[model samples]
Target: MKTLSKMHGPARERGVVLLFCLIILVVLLAGGVAVMRSMDTSLAGAGNLAFKRDLVNQGELAIAKAMREFNASGALAATGATSNNVAAANYSAVQLATNAQGIPEVLLKKTDLNGPDVLGNTFRPTGTPISGSGGSTVRYVIDRMCNATGTFASIGKSGCVYTPSKTETPGGDQSQLATPGPSVPSPPIYRVSVRVDGPRDTQVFLQASFTKPE
Candidate 1:
C-alpha cells in the first residue's frame, strides 16, 4: 500500500508540470501577436501622412502655375470662355462658395470641374514628371477680385488694386516727381484656388492671393 501511494504522487506531479508549460507557451504567443498588430497600426498611420503631404504639394503646384498664366496675359484675357484658350480653359466666374467668414471654401471635385466654366478650370501641366504624385488630378479657379460676377466694366468694378511703392528716386522725393511720372499701375490681386485629388482618397485645397503687373 505504501509503494502504490508513492507511484500515484509521482503521476500527479508530472501532470502539474505539463499544465504549467502549456500556460507559458500560450502567454508567449499572445505577446507576439500583440506586437505584430501594433507594428501594423503604426505603418498604416505613416502611410496616410505621406499621402496627405503629396496631395498638398500637388495643390500648391497647380495654384502657382495658374498665377503665372494669369500674369502673362498682358492684354487682359477675354472674359468669356473659348476666347482665351490658354493651356487650360479659363473661367471668369467666382464658383467657390464662402462661409460667414467671407473666405473662399469648397471641396472642389475633379469630375465636375474638369468639364466647363460653371465649375472652373482644370490644371494642365506643361510637362509630365518621370514619377508623379500617383497620377493625381489638380483643378484650379481664378476669380477676378470683384463684388459680383460679370464684366467688371459693366458692374463698375475696378480690377486693379493700386498700392504705390513709395521709394526715393534719383531725382529728390519719389512722390514729388513730375505730374505724369510714368503711370506705373500696381497689379491687382487675384484669388487662385487649387484642389488636388490623389489616388489614395487624398484631397487637398490651397489658395494664394496672387498679384502681378499686367
Candidate 2:
C-alpha cells in the first residue's frame, strides 16, 4: 500500500508540471504574435512617410518648370505687366513676351486662374501632376521675373519690375551713366509655390524662386 501511494503522489506532481508547461507555451506564443503585429504597423507608417515626401518633391519640380517657361518669355522687362492675361490665348502673349531689352516676363500661372483669354496663349503640360502609387497629387504655382539690373526677383502674388539706369548728367547720354541714380530696387524675385496631397489626409507645400541661369 505504501508503494502504491508513493507512485500516486509522483503521478500527481507530473500532471501538475505538464499543465504549467502548457500555460508557459501559450504565453510565449501570444507575445510573439504581438511583436509581429507591432513590426508590421511600423513598416506601414514608414512607407506612408516616404510616399508623402516623394509627392512634395514632384510638386516642387513642376513649379520650377513653369518658372523656366516664364523666364523664356520677355515679359519681365516691363513693370505693371499683369501675369494674368485673360485676353491672350492660353496666355501665350504673356507667356512669351520679349521687351526691347530682350528680357522675358513669363510668370507662373495660378491654378485658381483660368487659361488665357485667347487661344494658343496658355501653356499646356504634356504630362504633369504626376500621381504617385500611394494616391497622391501635386499642384504648382510659379512667379518669376528679371529686373533691368540683371538681378532676378520672384514675387508670389504681386507683379515684378525692371528699371533702366538713370542718366548721371542731367541731360547726358543715359547709357553712359556712371552709376544708377537713386532708383527703387527691382521687384522681388518670382516665386513658385507647390502643394502635394497624399493619402490619409497628408499634405505638403514646397516653394522655389526663379533664378537667371549662371
Candidate 3:
C-alpha cells in the first residue's frame, strides 16, 4: 500500500480545513461590519432628534420671555417703525406688507418662510444663547394681533377679534362656559414668532397667538 505522505493525504486534508476556516472568518467579519453600521446609524438619528427637541424648547422660552417683557413694562407697546424707538426690532403691519408679502408664515403671510420676497428674521438679538445648555442662538418677534401694522389703533376694520380666555371652538353642544359676549372687553392678543438655530444646520421656527389681561 502507498504511504499516506506519498499520497499527499495529510497536505490535501490540511488545505481543505484551512479553506473552510478562511470562509467562516470572512462571514464573521461581514456580519460584524453590518452590525457596526447599524449602530452608527441609530446613534446619529437619536442625536438629531435630541437637537430638534432642544430647538423647540428654546422657541418656547423665546415666547415666554417676550410675554414677560410685555407684562413687566409693556416693553413691546410701541416697538416698531411707527414708534420712536429707532433701535426697536419689531415691525409695523404696513412695514411687513410693503417689505414682504404681509401676514407672517403662521398667519399665512406667505406660502413659505422665505416667501413674500422679504419676511426675513426681524427679531431682536438679546445676546442670550438660544439653547442655553446647548448650541446656537435664539431670537423672537412680537406682532400685536391686527390687520395693519402702523400702530395697535390703526388695525381699524380687521383689528382685535375678541375670543374669551377659555374660548372653545364652535362645534358640538359643548357647554358654553367660555362663550364670548360682545359686551366683554376685547382682550389684546399678541402674535409671537421665534427662530432657533443650531449646529449642523439645525433650524426651527415657532409661532403662537396669545392674549393676556392688562
Q: How many steric overlaps are in each model, in order?
A: 0, 31, 2
Worst window of 10 by summed lDDT in candidate 3: 109-118
lDDT of candidate 1 over 91-195, digit per residue (tens): 334333554544344334335333323235433322221224679877665655544444433433243333343432444356665553553544445666666
- Winner on TM-score between 2 and 3 is 3
lDDT of 3 at 98: 26
User: For candidate 2, what is the total of clashing residue pairs?
Assistant: 31
Ranking by lDDT: 3, 1, 2
Query: Which segments of candidate 3 are over 4 A away from where they belong?
Result: 1-17, 77-135, 150-182
| C-alpha-based local distance difference test score of model 1 | 0.53
lDDT of 3 by residue, 33-149 (tens): 999999999999998888789888877887777666555364554344332221243322322222253335432321122222123434232234335446676665555444444
Which is better, 1 or 2, measured by lDDT? 1
Local accuracy by lDDT, each model: 0.53, 0.47, 0.53
Lowest lDDT 10-residue stretch of candidate 2: 86-95
CA shift at 130, candidate 2, in angstroms? Answer: 6.0
